[model samples]
Target: MSRVSILALALGLAASSLALTASAATPSANTPSAAITAAIADVNRPQADRDRDGDRKPAEMLAFAGVKPGDKVVDFMPGAGYFTRLFAKAVGPKGRVYTLLPGELATRSQKAVDGQKALAQDKAYGNIVPLVQPVNAPVFPEKVDVVWTSQNYHDLHDAFLGPADVAAVNKAIFDALKPGGVYIVLDHAGDKGSGLRDTETLHRIDPETVKKEVEAAGFVLDGEDDALRNSADNHSLKVFDPSLRGHTDQFVFKFRKPK
Candidate 1:
């Protein structure tokens, strides 16, 4: 073959190989499993939560977290039992979901605490356990399979809830998980290079800050997805502000403790 013909052939082969690698790495989001579907469709889930399903993407998030029957999960700071209830149903009868409520959050939002306790009593989601304790010290019932915290990850640094010793909490979470277990942190994103500065005012955190703190505890950054990201959000307003409440730009990160 001529030199130009040989070069084109080599480039095409490299492109084909790269395509195969990309295809292999991507998980199938189009087809959710039976367990995840049932959990999202559970009749007992409050309508309010169901309404927000489009924005929160619970099924996608659960599938991303790889929750399965018989897996033990720690829904860290599971406010209002939103993800907590979904987790309880997803894990099924053989599995368990611990709603890890901090003593600080209980003081801040008693209604959330009471709601969690009530769900634990209901037979439908009986697999839930409300584990309340100090923010810095996390004592899980058993080394868990997954420890997930949503929008509230930034609160661990805020004055209202924490100014919490984040390193201590991350270390505690590290110790509480089984080797190979996953730690998923989903939160709103602050502006570029802001680091932890926006956490208190915007209730948003720089994704880099989360990675640094989590990796310090010996966890590896496993995966991340843009499923919840909204490009329109500039990340300046508070997460709870009227215009930004449900549509804020968010990030989903999955970290794992190595075996």
Candidate 2:
């Protein structure tokens, strides 16, 4: 080959290699999922919800969860419908987002229950389905694509949630998912070795404890993302503590039911 032709081919190959590398890394993180981005930008989202976006990093977390259009998602213990609304939008018209309000929240306060019902009735994100799950015997209507709990998994071990049978909760989640479906547990991080010790007081639990418990229910650890990690958080303060409120160190785990 002529020297000029060889040089041109070498440059072309190098450019192609770089493009391929970038494409490979895109799906790994921070890449915009059209559905997620649209959901976040939806006009129906409350201003208060939007204000927390910077700290909560919903886009990154949603992307990590791998939510997509037409997915069936369970937003377990969906507090105030924050993620319920997001999931409904992200899943689009054909998908369904089930707001699994535990029995405590369902019966303890009528206002809370009414709020979820209200959200479900909204036309903007009419795909949301609201249901109350008994703490001890959680029930989901059908196998879904993803089951997710955010910042509240620790509550399952605390008194507020009947100190729910964590095992049963896990198993229900395992059963609620289709084979190969994902379960996402996102929560505040506790000190490395402290298992459930901090669940009630500090409102945190070690990341490993979550892995062990979920795995015990027959889920295989699939992937984890550090998108929400705040290294400066020492795992000592309550999640509501003013100094650490919005920026508390958090962990996001993805476990899959075996296919």
lDDT of 1 by residue, 1-259 (tens): 9999999999999999999999998768534668989999999999999999999998889998989889999988787788988888888999999988888878878797887789788887889888889999878779999999998899898896758999899999999999999999999999878998988888899998899999999999999988999999988789889988999999999999999
| Cα lDDT, model 1, residue 162 | 58
User: Given candidate 2, what's the lDDT at residue 169?
Assistant: 90
Which whole-number lDDT from 0 to 100 does residue 89 have in model 1? Answer: 84
Relative to the true structure, candidate 2 reaches a TM of 0.91
lDDT of 2 at 20: 99
Cα lDDT listed for each candidate: 0.90, 0.90
* lDDT at 110, model 2: 87
